[model samples]
Target chain A: MSRELTVVGLSHHTAPVEVRERLAAAAADAEAFLRRLVADCGVDEAVLLSTCNRIEVVTCSKAGHDPRQALTRLMVELSGIGAHDGDGLLFAMQGREAVRHVFRVASSLDSMIVGEPQILGQMKQQFEVSSSLEAAGPVLVRVFHKSFSVAKRVRTETGIASRSVSVAATAVDLASRIFETLDGRVVMLLGAGDTGETAARHFMAANVGQIMVANRTFETAVDLARELSATALPLERFRQYLPLADLVVGSAGGGQLLDAEDVREVLRERRGRPMFFIDLAVPRNFDPAINQLDGAYLYDIDDLAAVVEDNLGERRREAVRAETIVEAEVDQFWQWFEKLQVVPTIVELREYADSIRRGEVEKTLAKMQAISEEDRERIHQMTRAIVNKLLHHPTAVLKGEGSPTEESRLLSAVRRLFRLGDDT
Target chain B: MHTHTLMLFVASACYIGASLCYGASFSRREAPGARLAPWLLALGFGIHTLDIVRDVVSAGVLPVATFAGGFSFFAWLVVGIYLGLQARLSLAVVGALVSPLAFLAVTLDAIVRGDDVAVPQALRSPWLPVHVTLAFLGNAVFALAFAVSAVYLLQENLIKSRHTAGLIRRLPPLEKLDRLSAGFLMWGFPLLTLGIVSGGVWSANSTGHFWTGEPREILAALTWLLYAGLLQLRLLGGLHGRRAARWTIVAFSLLLTSYVAVNLLRLGTRHGLGLAG
Candidate 1:
């Protein structure tokens, strides 16, 4: 009997965050849970993945047992929830559907924020835990590695991961586009609004030359600056820093902070070097008319949102390409799996032939002790070659070199004919 | 009609093919085309090098001594420098612009301009090859700078207009282009200075005066001064981005017109305005 590979889980797609959070397993509990499935549930192979978004148990059952009920029972018991609690919340997929589901999960196709990259790493962490606990056997090992390559293929072949989807990323993208690089370029963060801090962090990560965070409250500015390892300035004196700033991000509260005249004065000080301004505030901080200046570019929150939306659309289109890659990989992996199915029978046939040859050669050698040692060796070699020749066609058939039906039929016939037994 | 000419033609065809691949890669935003483009350029460069060597061997003179030879040498240097930059930096997008420039240079070099003059005995010093080679190499690097600057300006416009998709996505970052152009200009400026100095020395030895105001000589001097000023501005004034890029483009244009186009035109003038002497 062929063992079944199954995955039973609850994800953000089918359950609320409250349910997902309750179902999530701590790191220590995850390993123990995988151990329980193998020790008590008659599972030959097991892997448990627990994340903020989902908790899934993947397993391959032993020959005579079905693991679905055991997995469901374990999940209910572990979460302290009734079996019928979140009716229709637990999804169960078996066989090829299970494989495809795992691939999608690993590639971030099924992520809450589609195209987000965290899911792949989360899956890898789960696999590592399963591996350390000795729960991942041949089947889970093959499937998990294939899932990683499928995710990488999706990333490179398609632009599914193209463009930044957040306001901070959009600001950084705009800054890079305008100035070409942030290296040796000064950035001034106007106000310590959350959005401003996020964008400033992005600039810091990009290795911008320097960052000066100015706020109306001097202590907040100083605190944020210390956190980011940047310079803090008083809001009143922010204009002094603007002349040296190649890029400026404004997320301060309330009225216009810099008018057109102020920008003009700064531009004169900068000698007309290009400056990009990303205004991430409500009611706007920079003068809208600063865009009219020759070397000045200003974008507000709405502009950044439009860019993010456009990128999300592009990512959706690229997701279609990513889906095609996933499908092709699934087909490739399925073929490998089908070939894996015949491996045990083929190994049985080779061992059966070799054992008979070795037995007959030992008997013949014992009786021919009066003959020379060279002739005795020759007899052994001759019998080994004949056994190999006799078994070559049967080995090929058992290994699925022929049609699938023919291969399976021949495999059964050979097993019975050689009395190789059902243990294989 | 000769084997080297035929080989040069083949190299031009390869460059044209590489240009199309890079163009398709940019428009389609696909990886296969971008991956194939650089290999095609490297192949063309190899064949182009062989073609130049064949000409130098058969003619018993440096390949930069004639109009067709000079352009071919310049094209070879452009592709050579471009391949180096491509290896060090991700410059497949720049290839879309550069591959065509190389093709044009090679095609012009293959045109058989019908005025093949011999090198004068007085002008046949060892410095002749060094001066011409350095000049062409400097010009080749500047041409690359021009391509990068053009891409930079295009990318800048896209960002300013708030349309940062498609072609803009294909380009290298704005800062990378700025730095790349500046680096090339800085390296080329000194070689250009040496080329000018050596050319002056060669001219004085042959014609007895280094300050003659021939039109080509004056134009060459002006091109050199413009690039010198651009470099100084970048070093002292933090001159970069749009202004530095614009000046690099202008200086390269002047170099092309005075160095290649004027020589090809071969106009009848009072000072005999050509490099043949």
Candidate 2:
């Protein structure tokens, strides 16, 4: 019998966070759930993937049983939600759709933030858990392994994950556009606002030469500097170090700290080296007119957000290319799976032919008691060869080269023609 | 057609093809033809080099003696230097900017058709090749600087305007472009100074005068002074980025105008190559 793959899950797309949290199982609990699913839920193999954004129960069942109804019931019970509520939240997919779902999830195409890297790791962890519990059979193992490689192909072949999508990341991206490498470049944080601190941390990660924290409150500056391993300076003395900064992020709450004239003086002192100013302040710390300075570039919070939006749009376009890759891979995997489905029908046909051949040979030998033992053995061998030759063409048509649709059709036709029971 | 002309045509076709590929790679989100463009450019440069060598061998002189040969040699040097720098820098967009200029220069060479000009009696000296080569090399370096500075301004405008989109990522950083432009100026200034000095000595030996006060000589001197001033301001006053880029464009425009006016139009008494004759 062919085993069918099925998935019943709720993701951020279908379920609210409150419902997902209730359905989300711990690692040990998920393993026990897989055990129960395989042992008593009419599932031959099962894996439960639970993350903060989603909870999916992937199962392999024999062709005769519909495990979806049983699995959905268990999920509703697990969530402690009403049956009607669970029906709206959980999505059920079987056969090729299930395979595609697994691939898309592993590739992060189905992620809340598309092209994020954490989904594939989370899937692999759950797959390993199921395998160690012996709840994952050959089919689940092959499907999970293929999903990993598909995710890798999607990552390398497409630009889905190449651009930065967050505000802090967008600031780094803009910084790189202005400067060649951040290796020896300096970044100054003016006021130690939360958003500015986040952007500074990103620059630090990019290996900026040094980070300076200057705030109106000197102690606050010192505290942030200690945490970030940077130098702290009083706000009054920040002008002394302004010329050294390649990137200056302003999060100070006060209005218009640096005017156009002040920045022009700084540019002259630095010898016209470019300075990128990210203004994350609410009331605007740097003068907007500073952007007009020849070597000074100013981007406020709204500008940074606009860049992030643009990057997200680019990622959406790349995701279209990634979806095409996933579709092709799914077709390839389904062909292999359909070929596996033909194996059982071929075995059943061979067994039926051999049984008839053995019965005819025995009956004939009983009637030929006057003949020698050598003649009897020769007769049995002759019957066996005739049966094998007659069955070869039928078996080859069922098992040999054809499309998945053609193979499945041939499998059922051969099964019925040979009177092979579907039970096996 | 002669093999020399046929090779030039083929090389020009390769450059055009490379430029289109680079344009496609730059304008699109995906860099599909980025790898193919370098190979196409290298092939064109190789064929152009061979064509120049053939001309030098057959004529028994460096190919800069005629207007056509000088234009072709200038294009060859530009492509050669760009290819060399492209090996080390991630500046593929510069190729898109440069290869079209090369194609245009080659096309200008074909139009002038000055390949059959005989070497003048006064010009038959070892100093002719030396002076022309140094001048052309400096001009080529400045041409590359011109393209780099153009890119720097484009990138700077995009960053300042907050339109960081598809084409900006393909371009090198502004600081790198600024630094490269300055480096080109520093190198080209000396070669140009030497070229002017050698031209003076050659003129004294051939015409019994060191200074001609001709239109071409004056323009060349003016071009040299402009570059010298720009380089001095860059080195000492720390003038870089947008202003430096604008100065480079202005200087190159002057150099290009002088070449077209004095060489192609035959405006000056000396250094015209006598294409009309």
Candidate 3:
């Protein structure tokens, strides 16, 4: 009898966006689907992770049962990705291979954008859904827990997820360095150009306190503000609102509009609270000298782009380090998983021998009519010692480390000799 | 070795372990090192405190009467205050910088002080403990500020040079570091002032003048003045970031120099009572 793990899925690497989106299940639906898989497909444990890029079902089956076909059939019926049509798109891995896949996916090593942090959170969400539905059992609990730990190890030991890979992201990241959270911090868009507007949208997504758009043309400002559901102001009135803005992103075509003196007065007014200036304008709307002011951080487009480029190369180097950590963790988890397989068989074999010995002793006792109670007690002790002595060698042998072939042979022989059922 | 000695050695060992953990956290790709480091430091701190109490009980006086004992007491306060800040801010990366400083102080004391040095007759006055306590506590806080300032400089340099990849993420946000360092400086300055004033009174009572004209005393005065100017700049003139961080390093270095000259080098007339000798 063999217990196996099977993972059947399609990811961005194997399938296009249309198929992935079609296959993806909502959290509630994924939970229900996992519960159904456990109840109806003879799967002992199951977890279904459904995201925009992938939908994976990891299943642990009962001994002597295969979960691949059942999972494939379920995928066809539920996700509408037919086994026949999804030939090149669908991928299925079994046992150690499946476990490795799950680890890599959770660690973001297998993500479309390697080292992105979202996949780990998504994996955790999937684990929670399966657990709440009572679909995840001991094996899956072990797997997912190890996956989470491995992901965490990769994140800390390597710089893979630490650096932002893009300029816009680095800009937002720099804002975070100034402010702990953008939640209640005002962001002022100093220009209505495409670059400034794009950055403003990023700030909006970060849940800034308010968005104020100012442009040379009031009409342009108003249009941009209305589109973003933000307030608009004329370019000249930007100074009036400067004190309220925690961050100013400038990208206008105009020449230096904010000089050192303008910023010095603003700082005096704001009482030296930190302000970040992202100058995306080519001519640099904010004077470079304003950066000399205390609590004022300035970054132009070229500066941010340079940071992004440098960080990408560094991330690539960190990825190699991250991969090593993942591989080491995979081997560790696999060793534990393999050891799990041998314990139950050894326990069953010992139990089978003990039960037979007990049955024989009872039969002998019943047949021994009028035997003294003291003599009966002595006989019981003798039988117990004999069973213990007789089982010691086999137990030692079973527990000892051996080659896989030799271990499996011994296990099978013990099962056959004692007539131990595989159901246990 | 005596049981007290053994206990102090154990405490030192724990501090070394904690330092390694904190150092490892800086380079680790995983979160375990950071998570484990604080608990290890706390464990070391408990053992260290126990050893200090044991030493005081056996000696019938505060162990800070001698240079070695003073260094040990200083290290203990540094670790204690670091742990306090860690509890409040979860500043594990800061621990990487702090733990080694503590390890150096403790190890130095253990190596240098094989036997207790005689307590100075002047230091036997009631003002002694007050002055020493305030001084060491101030030093501990300033040590924290120095570590934070160092980090600030490194982070600012990284951001300025556009090398945002490797270490920046491990650090706390720049503004948080700035705010925390400022808080430490504000807390330490008043205590340091009181400590200096108490030292002057102790000097006047013993030596007949507050102005000793000793090299150590002059350096101490200069250190105080530098810190005063730095604080004034920050509070009134609103000097922050790069300039403030650099001045903090300078002030702390001067303070350290004056402290080492007075205690380690015995730059002035002997203050010790020579009872143990």
Candidate 4:
């Protein structure tokens, strides 16, 4: 049997969002679409991964058939694009390259954000969908399982997924370092500016206890607070509420909202519980000197940007290590797959020899009627041993390590010499 | 070698291993060492416990009368308390800071004395064991507090200065460390008070005096006063965070200084007894 693996996909790296969105939208009925592809195309096993960032089809084919051309046409049709236009948007890989592409995609190395964690979960969901629909066969099941482990290894062994690369995320990361968990902690939104609001939203996602939005315009504060399901306070009285806040996100444009003395008073009132301040205003809302205070941590926009830059650099270094791990794992998986190719031939050869030996022994026993029953049992055992001994060397030779081409050639030669069927 | 000495050597070796493993957890990316370190420390703790029991059973007295025995007992108490706290808090970095201190104490004990010393006739009293045990236990708790305070200060400085790189994550949260330091101080202060009272009782019974103005006595009084003042400030004055951590460190330093001066150096005490015993 000539089993081949193939992958065809378009990601953020290749196609624009418009192209990816069309295919992703078309995959709303993913199970039905995947089942149809497996039935219509030459694909024996198929999995479709459709996310906002990418749409990919992973398939296994047999009997010397390549599924890439069929899969590409289906992708073009689903994307609702012209065939000529789809040529450059979609990339195809076969054999070892295809297996490596699936691994890299599952591991998030092929993601727009190189080390983002969502792609692995998306891959797992798609794999589960296909397997549940019976569209994924044994081969794809093994491939997906191996890819999950490879992704896990990359995550643990390398620092690829360890740090935050965005400014808002970095603020939350820093806050977490100061406080063990953000749960039940208060957040005071000093201004309703976009940057500060974005960071506050990130804090809210981390399960902060309450959000108090204070904007210079009382109506703006009320509107924003209503949208966020938070409490609104007049900006003038924000100082009174400062002690209640564990994290202060400032984006109110203007010079110096609160100085060191203001923070010192609040820190004393809070009884030395640490307070983290993220100042997103251009002219710096909080005094830089507040950072020197014992329980007060102040970071301006520039500081958060610097931390994000540093984390990005760290992630890039870790990505290189992850790529090395992916390559090593790909090689190991490919070796196992190549060895799997000769398994059918080994089984067929054993069955062919055993059948001939059993038939000849039965015919000979029918002629030798004078032979004792014990002697007949001994003869049957002898014939079984002789057949096993005769086939041992050839079976070992077929299963031994060899290049892919050499293994395929040897398999074909054995099939031809034994006059075995061509269905395998 | 005697079984007692052999056990001590084995225990010391285990602590050294634990120290290196805990230290490795800080620098390495994959911290397999962190997982192994606690097991090594526990093994050493068990063996050290057996050795202490053997000393008490064979010698018919507490094993803290000599300088070597006092250091060894103090090390055991520190590790024992740390292991207890570790069950509740994930303070691996504190372990890195603590195991080396344990190793140093055990190694010093091994080097300073080769054989067990009998309790002197003058020192053999009911109050001797009680006083020494309370005092060393108090010192052990304070030693742990000192380690926690050091971590708190480092973590607080890193967060305040905005230099929190990878090392910040390895340390516990600032608030957690501060609270832990205060908890240690709260437990230790009462123990030290009882220890000081028992020591006074022992001194009066042995020397026929309720008060002695030796340098050792004065140093102990000063150390005790500093801790008492800190506790008073923290409990009544709302003192916390950096100031509280600093005070705890300062008071522990004085206690350490007094121990070295009076017990190891034999500076001013007429009786030359080691470490409260």
Q: Kindly list the per-residue Cα lDDT of model 1 for residues A1-424, writing each as its tens digit.
A: 3456899888889878777777784324876677777887888888988888889988876433567777777777666668788457788888778888999999889998788999999899889989888898888999999999999989877788878999898888777766656777898999987889999988888889899999999999999999988899999999877898998999899779999999988887887677888898887999989887767889888888999999999999988888888888787776666566566656666787888888988886787658888888888888888988887876665654676556546655765687553444
Off by over 4 Å in 1: A25-28, A63-65, A178-186, A207-210, A226-230, A271-274, A292-295, A342-424, B28-30, B64-66, B111-127, B193-212, B259-261, B269-277
Q: Candidate 2 chain B: worst 10 consecutive residues by lDDT?
A: B268-277
lDDT of 3 by residue, A31-113 (tens): 56776777767888888888888988898886557777777777766656666877777789987788889988988888987
In candidate 2, how many Å is residue A368 off? Answer: 21
Ranking by TM-score: 4, 2, 1, 3
Candidate closer to the true structure by lDDT (higher is better), 1 or 3: 1
lDDT comparing candidate 4 with the true structure: 0.85
Candidate 2 reaches a DockQ of: 0.67
Candidate 2 — which pairs collide? none
Model 2 CA RMSD to the hidden true structure, in angstroms: 4.3
Model 2's chain A TM-score stands at: 0.83
Stretches of candidate 4 exceeding 4 Å from the true structure: A344-396, A401-424
lDDT tens digits, residue span B1-277, model 4: 7777778888889999999999888887897777899999999889989988888887777777667778889989999999998989978887887778777877776676656675677677788788888988999999888998999889888777668567887888887887888788889888998898898898899888767888877887888899889888888788888899998999998988888777778887676667652
Q: What tens digits encode model 1's per-residue C-alpha lDDT throughout B80-195? A: 98888777797887787778877886777777633344655754677777777877788888888898888878877777777877877778877788889889998999888888
For model 3, residues B133-216, the per-residue Cα lDDT tens digits are: 787788889988998988888877766555665677777877777777788899989988888887777777777788778776
TM-score of 4: 0.90
> For residues A1-424, what per-residue lDDT tens digits would candidate 2 score against the true structure?
6677899988899999888888884334866787777766798888888999999888888865778888888888888789988878999999889999999999999999999999999899888988998888999999999999999999988888878899888899888998999997899999976887899999999999999999999999999999999999999999999999999999997787899999999999998989999888889989999999998999998999898888899789889999999999999998888788788767767887889999988887888769988988898889889988998898778757887777767776775676565564
Q: What is the lDDT of residue B194 in candidate 1?
A: 84
Share of the reference A-B contacts seen in candidate 3? 0.51
Model 3 per-residue lDDT at A138: 89
Kindly give the stretch of ten consecutive residues in candidate 2 chain A with the minimal lDDT sum.
A25-34
Model 2, residue B127: C-alpha shift (Å) = 1.1
Between candidates 2 and 3, the lDDT winner: 2
